[model samples]
Target: VGRDKLLRTLQYFSRFYAWYLFRTNRPQTAIAPFESIKKQFGLTRKILRIGKFIEHFKAAAVAFDNKAPVDPILRCLAVGRQLGYAGYMSYDTITVIHALGIKKLANPKKMQENAYRAWLASLVCSAIAGVYSLWKLHQREKLVDRTEGEGAVELKKIQKYVFSMQERAAARVQLISDLFDLPIPLSGVGIVPLDDGIVGLSGTVSSLLGIWSAWKKTA
Candidate 1:
């Protein structure tokens, strides 16, 4: 709960910062958790796969824009699942759709373009973050890590591995959030798969507009 609160605070503040800095309609709520979650998972493997998914989706969106439509449904599903694997990856298409915006970004598309490297680095960083988080947790509760030589070494190694390259990931969460606009903190959303590979997002995001608005926009 404390962690979640801290993340939310960061996200809210980051959005303020992004708006102050970027002036785009995008939000950063979904970015930090998404990247963190992706790192938590196979940071290297899954991210690369998701990056490919984004690339394919971008190509398809362009083709569709040109009246040569290919299905973005599968790509949406893949993104959805990938987001889901991330701890805070929500199932709501409203917030989830923000992810698409980031994936399609051209200028700062490092996460998508260099999918493999970003993924690997993220995983490395996440592992580091995890260790420190654990250490903090252990400090709060002595049973978490003993203070013996081997224990100290284990703790030290985890700290070194994480902090050493952490600078690289400094903007990780913000980058992803800005990239995808996935951090809207929408209230209600759910998915229901229908026949013929069609899926529906059901719920509300903001104002009185729930999934209905999302449907209208997508429709």
Candidate 2:
């Protein structure tokens, strides 16, 4: 529980720092997109009447003017997300280590009880983090969609910022996915999956070692 709390604290700090930078370093005066397709083409009516596609691209070309890019925010987000994942990995590794130590206890039940509590606490914290990640991703997606819908003029002004957030979000999501789905390459012919399966296997091996230690004590 202590270790997980420490990791969680680190993750929160990373996010706080990112948000601080994002707010303080925000770019100046930006224009929103101009939605004209509904007014000129009346997309639904045109499609219903002619059963054909409307030339919205031409309309967009005529309306858009801004071409400048917005300040980038990906680096801030990338740093935070990577730190957060590092915390998670550390937490998981410690949890497995604790599980492996279970067999070394003379009174295994007491240690098991504490381990279960720690596991439960970590699980709850992990669930909260996962929810927050999902929520943040959803918010970023909305930002991307809003910017894109506004057309190129508005998009051009803030496209880079939105894309940066998107790229970071994609990378974070990929990292989380890869944690469970990908394999770790340590050296030649030393590839192994870095998922819960490995954690379980490692914990079991540790427990067996602990048993051996206890048997030696008895002997």
Top candidate when judged by lDDT against the true structure: 2
Best by TM-score: 2
lDDT of 2 by residue, 1-219 (tens): 233223323333333343444456643221111112212222222223231112222322322432445222432333333433333343334334444463343554444334334333333333344445566666766666575645566656476667656555544543343332222211111333243234333333433433444454467
Give the 10-residue window scoring lowest on summed lDDT in candidate 1: 196-205
Q: In model 2, which regions exceed 4 Å deviation?
A: 1-106, 147-219
Q: Candidate 2's error at 32, in angstroms?
A: 66
What are the Cα lDDT values of the candidates?
A: 0.34, 0.37
Positional deviation of 39 in candidate 2, in angstroms? Answer: 70
TM-score of each: 0.18, 0.27
